[model samples]
Every structure is written in C-alpha cells, then in structure tokens.
Target chain A: DAGVTQSPTHLIKTRGQQVTLRCSPKSGHDTVSWYQQALGQGPQFIFQYYEEEERQRGNFPDRFSGHQFPNYSSELNVNALLLGDSALYLCASSSTGGGDEKLFFGSGTQLSVL
Target chain B: LAKTTQPISMDSYEGQEVNITCSHNNIATNDYITWYQQFPSQGPRFIIQGYKTKVTNEVASLFIPADRKSSTLSLPRVSLSDTAVYYCLVAPGNRKLIWGLGTSLAVNP
Candidate 1:
C-alpha cells in the first residue's frame, strides 16, 4: 500500500504571492495534519482536518489554511507569503482508533519564499 | 500538555549502542511517550512509543519508567544510516502534541 504522498516536492514563491500544496493520505487513513519545519528545527503543527472539517490549528497566522476532500486528501494554502514562510511543509496521516496511534509523514514540500 | 526535553546532540561509533533520553517532568497522567527519527531534508519516521515499561520493536526500543516523566530510545548496534535527529514528544491529554527540539545522533565509522 502506498504511504502518505505530497505534491511538488519543491516550490518557489515570492512575498505577497500564494501557494498551494497537496497531500494524499496513506491507504486506510482518515485524519490529515500539516506541519511546517524551518531550517535546523523540528516540525511545527499547522492544522489538522477530519471528516472535511478543521479540527485543530497551531499558532500560524490566518494566511495559512487547508481543506480535506471527501477522499481524505488534503490541500494546504498559504497566502501573502512572507520570506519566513520558506520551509519544508510536511503532511502527516493517522487513524484515531488506537488512542496512541502515531503519525505517518510524507516526504514534504520544500517551499521557498523570496 | 507534557513538555519534553532531550539532548542537543550525541556521538558514537558504529557497532555501539546509542541511548537518547528525554525528560518530561510534567507529563500528564494519560500522556504517552513517542519517538520519531528524522534525516536531513526528509520527514520524520516513527521509531517507537510507550506508555510505561519497555516496548521493543524490530527497529528500536522505548523505555518508560513508572513515573512516566522521562523515557529513553535505545538503538542497538547502530549503523551510519542511523545518524539522524530523534524527537521525543508527549501525546497530550487532549490528543494534541508538540515536538521538542530533538536529539541529533551522529554515528561514526
């Protein structure tokens, strides 16, 4: 079975521009979460989507938003991108059954903001 | 949410066993300790997780004491490919989590 996959392994955008990244959840998974990792830092939570609704979000600005499709795929959108928005965006998927289920992450999308 | 603390870096030779410990002094009663391994420019991979006691998997082992305030990730006979950043995080009471800075392991020849 294929694992979590993300699109456009790398992307480049300029300040005030917008970018959209996509993610396909692992087979048999329903929950999708997004994270942002800067150079030399750990991944930080962005938001989580379940049943086509946003569940939780981190401290990210309103410029960051996301949506989960009926098939459990997800899209992360960042508007008015700033220089600091450049980072690796990771998509993770997990099931909610095993209360302690671990998240499976995709290779990540490297976003470069100029 | 429980806050985790791990070392900044560690160094060991190949064929040696490496143990990275994490401290979460305020761990909640229902929190579980989980570890993830990440390589440069790649997303993290789950290593092992535990609530209490020792849980061993094919790749690694997680040791959580009864107090549940700290845990250790032990990699036996580590190889060069094992060089990566290891993160320890607490699956909080609300099921939300925040990853710590993580420990960087450098396996030498």
Candidate 2:
C-alpha cells in the first residue's frame, strides 16, 4: 500500500506572499494532522482534522489555516507569510478507532520563504 | 515544559543495537509515550508507543518503566537507512496535539 504523499516536494515564495500546501493521507486513514519543523529542531504541531472538521489547533497564529476534505486529504494555507515561515511542513495520518493511535507521516513539503 | 527529555543525537554502526531513552518526570495521568522516526525533509513515522512496562512490535521494542516516567526505543541491528531523527512525544489527554523536539539518530555504515 502506498504511504502518505505530499505535493510539490519543495516550494519557494517571497516574503508577504501566500502559499498553500497539500497532503493526501495514507490509505484507510481518517485523521490528518499538520506540523512544522525548523532547522535543527523538532516538529511543532499546527492542527488536526477529523471528520472534515478541525478538532484541535496549536499555538500558531491565525495566518495559518487548514482544511480537511471529505476524502481525508488536507491543505494548509499560510497568508502574508514571513521568512520565518520557511521550514519543513509535515503531514501525519492516524486512525481514531483506538484510544492510543499512531501516526503515519508523509515526506513533507520543504517550504522556503525568501 | 514537555513531559519528555531525550538526547540530542546518537551514533551507531551497522548491525549494532541502538537504544535511545527519554525522560518525562511530569507525565500526565492519562498520557502515553510515543516514538517517531524522521528522515531528512520527511515527516515523522511512528515507531512505537506504550503506557508502562514493555511493548514489542515487529520493527522495534519499547521499554517503559513501571513509573511511566521514562521510555526507551531499541532498534536491533540498525543500518545506514536508520540514520534519522527520532522523536519522543507524550499524548496526555483525549486529544493528541502535543509534539516536541525529537532525538537525532545517526547510523554509520
């Protein structure tokens, strides 16, 4: 079975621009979560979506938003982006049937804000 | 502060066992410890998780102490492909939104 997949593998945009990143969850997965990892640091939570609704969000600002389609694919949008927004944007897939669920991740989109 | 503290990085040779430990002194009552592996520019892949005691799976074994305050990830006979960052995360509540710094593991050929 194919694992999770992300688009554009890498992206480049100017400061104050807007960018959209997409993720397709793994097969048989229902929940999707997004994360951001700066250089030499750990991945930070952005938000999680289940049943086409955002269930929880992290400490990121409003400029960061996401949507989960009925098909379980997700999109993360950043508006008026700053240089700091450049990082590895990760997408994780998980199942909800069990109380303690594990996530399967996709090779993230490497966003570079110039 | 997160509930876990692990090493920044570790080194291992091919066919050698690699063990990475994390410390979580203030783990939540309902929290479970999870470990993830990430290659460069890739998302974190879940390795294993356990609440307490020990849990073993096909790929790796997770050893959690009785106190639930710490956990270890043991990889048997690692290879160069195992050179990646390993993250330890704590999910304490109904929602699993907590993610922190993961340990970096470098496996030499």
Candidate 3:
C-alpha cells in the first residue's frame, strides 16, 4: 500500500500572501492532522480533521485553517503569511479505530515565506 | 495534554544499544506513550508505543513502568544510520498528540 503523500514538496511565498499545501492520507485511514516544524525544533500541532469536520485544534491563529475532503485528502491553508511562517509543514494520518491512534506521516512540504 | 521531556542529545557507539528516556510527570491514566524517529527534512516515523509494562516491535522496544510517569525507547544494535531525532509523546486515544523537543541521538562508528 502507498504511504501518506504530500504535494508541492517545497513552496515559496511572500509576506501577506496565501499558500495552500495538499496531503493524500494513507490507504484505509480517515483522520488527518497537520503539524508545523520550525528549524531545530519539534513539531507544533496545528489542527486535526475527522469525518470532513474539524475535531481538534491547537494554538494557531485564525490565519491557519484546513479542510478534509470526502476522499480523506486534506489541504492546509495559511493566509497573510509572515516571515516566521517558514517551516516544514507535515501531514500525518491515523485511524480512529482500535483505540490506538498511531500516526503515519508524509514527507512534509517545506514552506519558505520570504 | 501531558507534556513530555527528553534529553537534548545522546551519543553511543555503533554496536551498543541505545536507550532514551522520556518523563511525563502529569500523565493521565488513559494516556499512552509513543515514540517517533525523524531524519532531516522528513516527517517523523512511528517507532513503538505502549500503555504499560512493555511493547516490543521489529524496529524498537518501549518500556513503561506501572506508575506510567515515564518510558524508555530502546534501539538494539545501533548503527550510523540510526542517527536521528527521537520524539516522545503522550496522548489519549483519539486525542491530538503533544510534542516536545525530542532527543537527538548520534550513533558513531
């Protein structure tokens, strides 16, 4: 089975612009979550989507939002990007069944806000 | 969400086993401990997870004591390729995971 996959492995955006990153979850998974990893730091939770609705969210601002399509694919959008928004945007997928939520991650999209 | 704390860096020889411990003093009874390894420019990969006692898998082993306040990830027979950042996370089932700055392990030859 193909693992999680993300689109536009690398992206460049200028301040005050908007950018969207896409993610195709692993086969047989339904829940998708997004994370932001800054240089030399651990990933910061952004939000999680389940059943086409946002179920959980972190401390991110309103400028960061996400959507989960019917096919279980997801898109993360960042509006009014700031220079500090430059980081690796990671997409992780997990199953809500079996009571154990182990995440399968995709090679993240590197976002650079100039 | 229970916060996790791990060492900043660790070093070991190629043939030696490596054990990295994580502390979560405020862990909840329903929370489970999970570990992930990440290489530069790549997303983190699942290593092993456990609720109590021990859980062993092909890649590594996870040990959790009865108190469940702490856990250890053991990688056997380390090699240079094992050099990466190891993250320790604690979260309940179906809940969002909380991540801390992980342990950077460097396996030397």
* Per-model lDDT: 0.91, 0.86, 0.93
lDDT of 3 by residue, A72-97 (tens): 99999999999999999999999987
Poorest lDDT segment (10 consecutive residues) of candidate 3 chain B: B91-100
Residue B99 displacement in candidate 3 (angstroms): 0.7
- Model 2 docking grade: medium
Q: Which ten residues in a row have the lowest lDDT in candidate 1 chain A?
A: A94-103
lDDT for each residue of candidate 1 in B1-109, tens digit (9 for 90 to 100):
7788999999999999999999999987777788999998888998888899999999999988889888999999999999999999897422346877799999999
What would the TM-scores of all predictions be?
0.98, 0.92, 0.98
Residue A66 in model 1: shift from native, Å? 0.4
Question: Model 3 segments beyond 4 Å from truth?
Answer: none
| Each candidate's DockQ | 0.57, 0.58, 0.73
- Fnat for each predicted structure, in order: 0.42, 0.54, 0.67
For A2-114, candidate 1 gives per-residue lDDT tens digits of: 99999989999989999999999999989999999999998999999989999999999999999999999999999999999999999999986665878999999999998
Two-chain DockQ for model 2: 0.58
lDDT of 2: 0.86
Model 1, residue A17: displacement in angstroms?
A: 0.6
